[model samples]
Target chain A: MSTAKISLRGVHKAFGANSVLNGIDMDIAEGTVVSLIGPSGSGKSTLLRCINLLEPIDDGEILLDGIDISLPGFDANPVRRRIGMVFQNFNLFPHMSVEDNITLSPVRTLGVNKSLARAKAVELLERFGLADKVNAFPDQLSGGQQQRVAIIRALAIEPEVLLLDEITSSLDPELVGEVLDVVRELKTSGMTLVLATHEMGFARDISDLVCVLYSGHIIEQGLPSQVFSAPQSERAQQFLERIIRAGRL
Target chain B: MGTITGRRAAYERARKRRSTVVATVSSLAVVTAIVVLVPKMPRWDRVHESFFNGERFAHSLPRLLDAFVLDIKIFAWSMPAIVVLALLVAITRNSRSAALFPLRILTIAYTDIMRGVPIILWIYLIGFGVPGLGIERPWNSPLIWGSVALVLTYASYIAEVFRAGIESVHESQRAAARSLGLSSWQTMRHVVLPQAIRRVIPPLMNDMVSLQKDVALVSLIGPIEILRQAGIDKSKFANFTPYIAAAAIFLLITIPLTRTTDWLIERERRRTTGTRIS
Candidate 1:
């Protein structure tokens, strides 16, 4: 049997009286694409954040490669290093250049040599069509370019699973395509990817397994063809219907 | 048509130059008139003897300059001490970790009490009172006590400055850093502090100007800086000419510092906004 790469069991999260993730359970196998799709306040982003331990789950275990990492006092850095994350705001360090941003974690944390790290960073930038923007600061780049650089910085660490939380939500419509193209390219290369996205059409197109989260619950999940074309749950059906009515799907 | 336009532009440039020259001449004339008129006023001669006596000013210059060296020494020594202390206090004050809770309260109180009390009072308490308290070796030297007082007092203000810089960095930056698997301290050092320090440089330099001026306050503890030298000259000659010289020296340092702060603030604004006038 092929074991799961990242798994969660009964994960629960809350903020004061407001419950964000009531119960989340999923086992993402290696070399597969998982898309979490839901409207605002449904905990899609929260689920993605929990994978990298950005948000502590109130209860339950987050297992990465069959080992529980949710225990208190666990050194999160090792696990975090193994899982790459990209944010909606493309939070690249504004004070650092794209090259430095890509090199920082690898050089400082991974004990990579300065020249090796720089060489690797240059390679990634060139591969991603950002060769000219290496010396450019985050503020100097367009939103799409900044997000692409952020993705490259995440990949620089050579993470096992890439978690993208609404990575293209903040981009303009035209700019969204550029970032989506990068994700599509990553998927074709057999990367284990989990993404929370509002781009329904793109999600429908890219996801191997589409999960519809509703009010912190996974209301429906299956092959993208099954879920998108024939959702079983009423909540999932209505949600997709609403998106269709809004001309989003 | 081209000649007409070119001629008009030349005429406009000439007019601008003429107005600038006229403004300069008028400013000089006004200043000269004020100086000449003020000197002729009743009791101006006595006032001149008290504050502008050339002989006393020239004599006090060398003494004041020599004493000013001590002020620079105290200033140089106190800076690193205050910077290190303030940064620790600010980090402690800003920490959300439960273990830092007690330290947070202590730093808050320290900043509050130190800032609330006057620097002169610290000079009095540490510089004089510490010695009387029989605190042994380090307390005995006025230089040490005086520098300690300046450091303690200035750290509170500088800590607040550092804390502001630390907090002004957007929360998303921290989240991004942490999400990278960077520990909190590493994130702060690599990501947050760089931005924060850049933003606060102008304010920090302004604080340094305050520190530079307050370096004269060590004079109360018997280190004869420029101000103290003026007091010595005043008593010896029964005139205030030396005080005028000291004031001029103070202005000499302060004016450039103020201009530097303005220039730095402007440059920071332009850099952050990604806009510049060529």
Candidate 2:
């Protein structure tokens, strides 16, 4: 698959002996969508965070384009600049307008000029159907709109890969579809995507590879259709059973 | 329906006017009673001959006011320095970098020592000790020393206020900024300080009120500010009216500032909580 845009080898992380990612190993091919599905506290979010270098790994290597990124003393800013992360809680800068929130990193860290950054912000806002809300403060928007703004803000950085951490889980039941629609569009445009999510239906429909994590271990991973139909491990089967009982699958 | 609503509005306006009239009359009566009764008392005969003498008030007004300008000058000179120093100290203390550990300890010690002793003591120590040491130029001028003492004294208090503001910003904001590839300093300058500084304005203004009054303390160092001028007048005329006049001028300056700060605090509370006052 043209060598992988990014690869994780022996990624281990823990918070004071409560291990989160225990010797994780995976490789993400370019332009492919990978989904990490598991029960809560099963290390899905932590793994995504480690990939972005938001959380430091205890031991292992995360190589972006065959260059080791997770090594200690490697400045994470350059690597982080190429990886965009959308948090679950929106985390839109409350003090800034929607346009400013989208353009801040581009202008500040990227050295993009004011006029171009603003133009890019305007174009993205229009693409997301948020043109009317450009000057609006984040507190003035709904949970769904805020989340969309966050995703668009991440997109503004022009990152090589996008990481989303439960982007739709915080939205209202009716508001969830709008955010997912944006993700679907991203996939159709051949953007590489990794997400930790609770949406089993969406995961099955979109992901190229689905990894089932359980208690800090990736016990099962393969094509979504195969894993959904036939989970090999007892824990994965039980996890899927819970999803079924909850009517989420 | 229009007539009824218009009539209700008129009635509300009338009621408000009546309440205002009642408040005005009550206040005027209090003033009028003091004016009439105090003059009638025997003590007024003695007090007025000395203190309320129109001629003395007229004579002292310009002289005392001229000296008061030095206090204003000291306050003006010290304000910008105080703000900049407080931000520096607060940032130093709050930094997570191990390289700043010594600076953090120093900042903590500065705040602790400056806050523990009375502000007057700092003024005394700096204003008296520095010049007594026979230092040159800025350190030697009592005027400069008084200003330096005020800035040092007030910056410590203001630094604590700033630290509280910085800490009050949610940790998630920092996380979000860093996730976007903003460095630690960039995140602080953009995402954190703007919000924190806004949150702190009311408290900072509260400290400003304290500062405005404390500028009077510089009089002890021999700058011939309002209080010192008043002291001279008291000794010359054998009356306490100069003290009262000095206090009145201080109230004129500080009371409005204190009131404005109170209003700002209320507005800040409403804005932060996303509430409407109506």
Candidate 3:
């Protein structure tokens, strides 16, 4: 059986005159965490979005378990069903409570029974230490709590791969560590994760592989130690130096 | 410190005196104008005779109640239809596909034309002209024509309201829903519409109050509504009191709705402030 959970070859995307993802190649193995880190406008979030076809690629082939997902007539829905995403803004449905927000996709898209979805939601909430917040609205929760709920909401579908797009960026400085702790737990549990983040320390600590993206291309990629400690490319070395100088790493 | 407190007290007293003077002047002017106009007004003697001394009041009262009933019936039936059509129009307007352009244009044209021409003109054209085209009424009731007119005109306005509401929902919400594997329709129904509809409730309630008042315009099309009954009574007795009574009834119906509109506005304001603080 094939081991690659996701594979993207020469994936390209452009918005009018601005090319966002240019000739990108990536492979994510099963049950591994790969962190994509870069400065703003580096297209890390776009790449994460493109995997679920949330942002359509201008060119390339994306494969899941060696099955061509980018091919015409391929059902995007089932592909999306297999992949879950968490947003930077914690896009919890404001009209719903935390429990309802978590159960919405399972009940509506997957045809899961409400009672079953609710049960699963409660389980996930308990696991995330958010059992007490089940009936609270999204607006009633802190940023850290909301992001935790978003993660659990994505996991309710039991997806093979989880894509996180800067999930802690909108958080308060003091609240950032709480959300990263949940991510760290997911990493230990062997969830296949593709995370785009600016959290250098968290990426170094939790990621199996870290890929440095710059100007719509992967400038360097390797084990976190290789990329952070002994980057082969001058660009990657300079990027790390900038992060260290900024007192982030 | 004592001087500062005295100055603050003086400022407060001055502000109160200014406001009180303005209020008294306005009240005196309004009262003086009413006193001057009261004697020149038409006599209530003939009106009292018709309303209290005869069958005119009895006949007109039932007719007015029937008209009220018809108005309520028409409004109830047409509101749902308007909501559905407005939603459809709103969706088509927001569609990006090339195939939807024609539909978008047609909807825009429909809204523009209907909004530009008065509702009464549309009533006359549809009520009088459509029958000439061999489209027989299902039941020969003026209620149907008046309702058709209200729905057609109000649907256009409501469509714009729906579109504005939908547009007001943050674009980030749409992107977030899509990334979560929701289809376009699913995103709209589950995420966008709920928030959008909440934002629009106050305006929609305002429109409904206006709609209740506009129902009186249907009297122009030979319906024996409250206003029409008042006209008949006035012609018989040469008294304007029945018309005043009709005006009072209209106010009675609309005042509660106006209060509801105010309450909704206040609730929405509180929600917005609450969301911001959170």
- Enumerate residue pairs that collide in model 3: none
**Cα-based lDDT at residue B78, candidate 3:** 81
Model 1: per-residue Cα lDDT over A1-249, one tens digit each: 228998889999998999999889888999999999987899998888888888888999999888899888888898999999999999999888788899989988899998999999999888889999888878878899999999999999999999999999899899999899899999988899999988899998999899999999999999999999999999999999999999998
In model 3, what lDDT does residue B191 have? 92
Model 3, B1-278: lDDT tens digits are: 99999999999999999999999999999999887776466984553565554455555666667667766776688888888888898888977668789999999999999999988898887766555566556754566777788888988999899899999999888876776667778889999998888888878877887887787777787766677777887887776656666766777877888797778777755543325542
User: Chain A alone, TM-score for each of the models?
Assistant: 0.98, 0.98, 0.97
A1-249, model 2: which lDDT tens digit per residue?
Answer: 238988988989999979899988888999999999999999999999999898889988998998889988799887888999999998998888888899999999999998999999999989989999888888878899999999999999999999999999889999999999999999999999999999999999999999999888899999999999999999999999999999998
Considering TM-score, which of the candidate structures 1 and 3 is the better prediction for this target?
Answer: 1
2 or 3, greater by DockQ: 2
| Pairs of residues clashing in candidate 2 | none
Q: Share of real contacts kept by model 3?
A: 0.37
DockQ of each: 0.57, 0.51, 0.35
**TM-score: which candidate is best?**
1
Decoy 1 TM-score against native: 0.92
The candidate 2 chain B region of ten consecutive residues with least summed lDDT is: B269-278
* Worst 10 contiguous positions by lDDT, candidate 3 chain B: B269-278
Report the TM-score of the second chain of model 3 against its true counterpart. Answer: 0.76
Better of 1 and 2 by TM-score: 1
Q: All candidates' TM-scores?
A: 0.92, 0.90, 0.87
How displaced is residue B270 in candidate 1, in Å? 5.7
